[model samples]
Target: MLGYPIPANETQRLAALHQIKLLDTPDDPVFDRVTRLATRLLNVPIATVTLIDADRQWIKSRVGTDTRETTRKVAFCSHTIAEGAPLVVEDARQDPRFSANPFVDCENGIRFYAGIPIFSSEGYALGSLCVVDTQPRHLHEDELAALKDLTDILNDEIRLREHLTREQQRRAISQRELDALHRSLEEQIERRTRELNLVIESAYDAYISADENHRVLDWNRAAAAMFGWSRQEALGQSLQALIFPHGVPEYDDATPIEVNACRRDGRETPAEVRMKSLRVEGKHRYSLFLHDITERRQLEQLRDREAREDALTQLPNRRALDERLLDAMARARRLQQPLAVLFLDLDGFKAVNDDHGHAVGDELLRDIAKRLRHSVRETDYVARWAGDEFVIVLEGMAPEAIQGLSEKLILTIEAPIQLGEMSLYVSTSIGVASYTPASNETAQELLKRADVAMYEAKQAGKAQVKIAQQGKA
Candidate 1:
């Protein structure tokens, strides 16, 4: 049985041990020299720079030993690390802890043992510099001091080996990542090449690709037909001069360059160009994909407008609110200004939906959304939270101003909505909460408080505004 005890903060010690990175490594001459000296000076058959880890004692350098590791429970170095100083046992057979130990009882009987703790610069005991002999021998004070000096040397060597191993592993990992990136780039190039071939074969637009030096590498059938020159003549020509004959003189240097290509019958056609960097055959290159987007640009603009605008009420949706809210919250918090959040819910929306069709109710709700937006300041945001719930975020407002705004919101929604020939009436309940620097609450928590206040308002009356109050203990 081993008498060694682990440190209370063993995790921190082990982390520091790993930081040195000296465990289970190939032999170093720096460590080998000291262990060799330890064997000679201590007059021992075995000398080792032994590191006690979580489960085993690893030999960093072994002068007269063939084994690399031994169980921690039976390791003498474990006791050395625990003692944090030299542990000299003149006779293992007389020492109770080692009397039954295999090293003492077996053929390689250890009667003489002297171990000095190897400590980190920060003073954590890592392992030991130890010497063992079969015959019993006592160590003088001078010999013990010499052993301590030898341990310091071994500690320095272990630290150096750890640093070197970590650096080597880092370089290996970096090289592996670079190799993977290169393979990924090659696969991407092959995939893009196949896609370009398909586009050239089927597309009506004139497509072209070029090297990094701006020399053409690909001239599609459409490009050859559109330009006056055949595919053979246009294969390696300068795209700038050959295509944009009358455009800006420095068009080639301009970013996202646009140009006009001349046809064989002396007709000019418009084209849009985009350039991308690539690698080919171990060399850097660039590619240009051209399109006739004159008519397509109008349709794309229409699509972008539809994407940004809400389809039902034609108002900006929660996505736009999120973008604006981030900026607003940042500016308000920076200035130590207060911002108000209002959670609004329609009082009789479900009744309307059940009585009339959903379509009519939706139209009525859209009318109500327009009214609320018109009532608020242009700087304030009014966004639909869900089916019949909306939220308004007012920036740079005081508590009194927030109270006034919440009341105005309720009054605005309480007014009758004129949908076609019929008049529909609905009420809104609002809960208001403010964000203050003194509160230290998160944005989500503040919003939740506002939501709870809104429910409180709904409970109090059909159409009212309520401010949140902290419940008394």
Candidate 2:
């Protein structure tokens, strides 16, 4: 047997062959039908459509054979492909090319061989469609022409198969690209949706959205908690019936209204509500947002009280006392009446604080405040001016009345305060100043005179009262 040299571009040729992606695939009836027809028309015992690869000759279709592949070097179709034409050995025993071939001497003896090269469109001889016989025979011109015609038919089939294979591959690649694009679009939509949800949740003002017929469509956490309703309970319910069964009467055709809404805990909370009508899915709906104003109203009331009362002792402080003193001065000037101011200071209160504790001294001061408040008329103002010092404003009072009230307050605060398991004694020095506003006396001048007189009383003795001279006023 003569050895045939492998082609120089054999590796590239095989690579190109495999690039068509047609190896080791399941059998197809179209190629099988063509091979069957070839065997019957040519009157051959064996026929095959063999595709030659790098290491093996694989049969794409075969008739009258169980084997699908054989070694490439020994395969007759391999030589036919290399020859690049039809190869015919009328008698294998007589032909030098195959005289010593194993097929000639084997039990399944081969005496005739004919093969037509299957050329690809690119002119690469891929394989062959071949017929073999065990009996020596010679082919007539008609028989040879018929075999060539069948080989042409085989070539057309291979071309059609290659076209279909390429088309199927293109379809698969296109489907993959479409799937990837769809996945990308879905991911973008999901990312945008999450960002929108985050913005809605973090908003400071509560926001809610609902479908038509007042059924809840969406509720944020702030909205849920603000109305004291859980998300689960609030969804898909009539907003008016759930929150405000009795509609706010203040909401006329033009004006939006505020109302008290009942919370989950049965507390009535003040809220300002605004509503608007909308259409969804061809039906009417309403959206409502409520703002709770309970804390704001309470703060306003507290501010009013703080404006007129002292923070420390809960009494009328200097600002309040000053206003009343000016009022008394106005009335005194108009009616030719007298007004008086009494200044009192707790004596040895600091010494008591240092000996005992500031807590006990604070209790003592509070007790003195109660006594001082009780000693004055309802019209008079008693206020803590500073630490351990108090001032009293007396309206429409003469000199004798001023002296009498000052003494009473002095005696009241000078009494001992009884603490638990302890007794604390404290004294006060009182000073009185009388003013007839018609005598060109101002409120400040009267206050200064009372301050000076209080110091004089302290010098005279503790627990005593002194009156300012008329010349000072």
Candidate 3:
């Protein structure tokens, strides 16, 4: 009651604990299995996975306990979390921290306890996996090691659950946005349809009316201008022949769709078309609206390209590199060809940033990216993996060719870069790792080998190449 331990980073630690979303949740078998294994392996009466909250220790999984939680001040796991390490109390009755505690002094009191702190991805102590014994007992070295390993497994599982929760929340937000957009679009269409004739003459979109037989009944000035025909010439013309010379696009309902619209000058324009069916004088008629969407489509394409490209260098980003790696590996496996990955790191990049400022450092990186791109064949995939780091995936290349390319890239990166008036010099350390069908290595494994080799190159000297030894799964 008098000696409550609190962590230095209590606030961040509590936030991380709640972010995992395991506190006060239903019992998960995955965690329960680990607790059960701990009880069996450690010969303990109770094994629990406990999360330390602001005022309570919530048990997420338990092997021998009906109680869900206990006050943090009285919980032994609290001390374990406070230490951020494994806490082993061989005899709680003799230990000063638990000698007067109710859980230790009460009938059938806890006498032995061992707990390993579980950490969050950001290195905050979230909780602990603990075992309790009614009789005082000492844990053997092997038992302590086993407990640590099981705690690591729990740490991974907790991180995975947190990641999945974040992904689900992200997807839910996107779905809600899509639904709102759909609703808004429908409302706009309905309102525009009600005020059609009032604004048709001045509206930017082309409006056309035709009978059920597809013969034009009315043509607005916008339609004539869009199709390069006068209203007098457009009226009474076959609607399909006037704009849809390539044939009308498929539009099942009032939803808008993109189609190729033919102009009188024989040019094709991308347009968004919306059709509405109406009955006038007991005769069926179709009203069409066409809006040119060329600029919209081009903007969308640019957005997609930016998503996969690095903004600074206009090179493929890490996301694009990952996709390319997977595709290249699949093709190599199918064709029984050799593939290689060249990992590059700019030497003394941090020094450049510190001495010349990030602006100049950025210019240097862009120059390096360009040089690396030019050094490799156009068929090779070059991507900016991260700041001052690049990855190049090459397929159907022999080991010797890959070696030559890596050396060339090193030399190419060593050249002076002119940033306005100042000429900056930097070199690259290159690592080459190859993969074949017989190697049975994953894309990540291959990249990791190359990265390790690059570090070796850096350790050996500033500007050099290191080839990675072939690795297996």
Candidate with maximal TM-score: 3
How accurate locally, in lDDT, is each candidate? 0.79, 0.77, 0.89
Name the better of 1 and 3 by lDDT: 3
Residue 200 alpha-carbon offset, candidate 2, angstroms: 1.7
Highest lDDT among the candidates is held by which one? 3
After aligning candidate 3 to the native by TM-score, how far in Å is the CA of 149 from where it should be?
A: 99
Error of 2 at 313 (Å): 34
Sorted on TM-score, best first, the list reads 3, 2, 1
lDDT of 2 by residue, 1-473 (tens): 42654655677667657756656878878768767877787788888888888878898888878888877766887788787878888888888767777768788778888888876666677887788888887876776677778778767776776787778878889989889888998898898889878976765545566665556777677777777777788888665656666643333434556788766676777776666667777876555566778887799888877986777677887787778788888987888776788899999899889999888888888888888888878887888887888998887766766767777776777676889878788889988888866577777888888888899999997788988877333
lDDT: worst 10-residue window of model 3: 245-254
In model 3, the runs with Cα more than 4 Å from the true position are: 1-196, 420-423, 437-442, 471-473
* Per-model TM against the reference: 0.44, 0.48, 0.55
lDDT tens per residue, model 3, 1-473? 53678999999999888876788788788999999999999988999999999998898999888879888988998999899999999999999989999988999989999999999988898889999999998899999999999998999998898898888878888999999999999989888876776699888999898888788888888888888988888878887789887665665465798898999989988999998888999998888899988898899999989999999999999998989999999999899998899898998889889999998888888888878778888899999999999999998988877777778787788788888888888888988898867777888999999999999999998699999988885
**In terms of TM-score, how similar is model 1 to the real structure?**
0.44
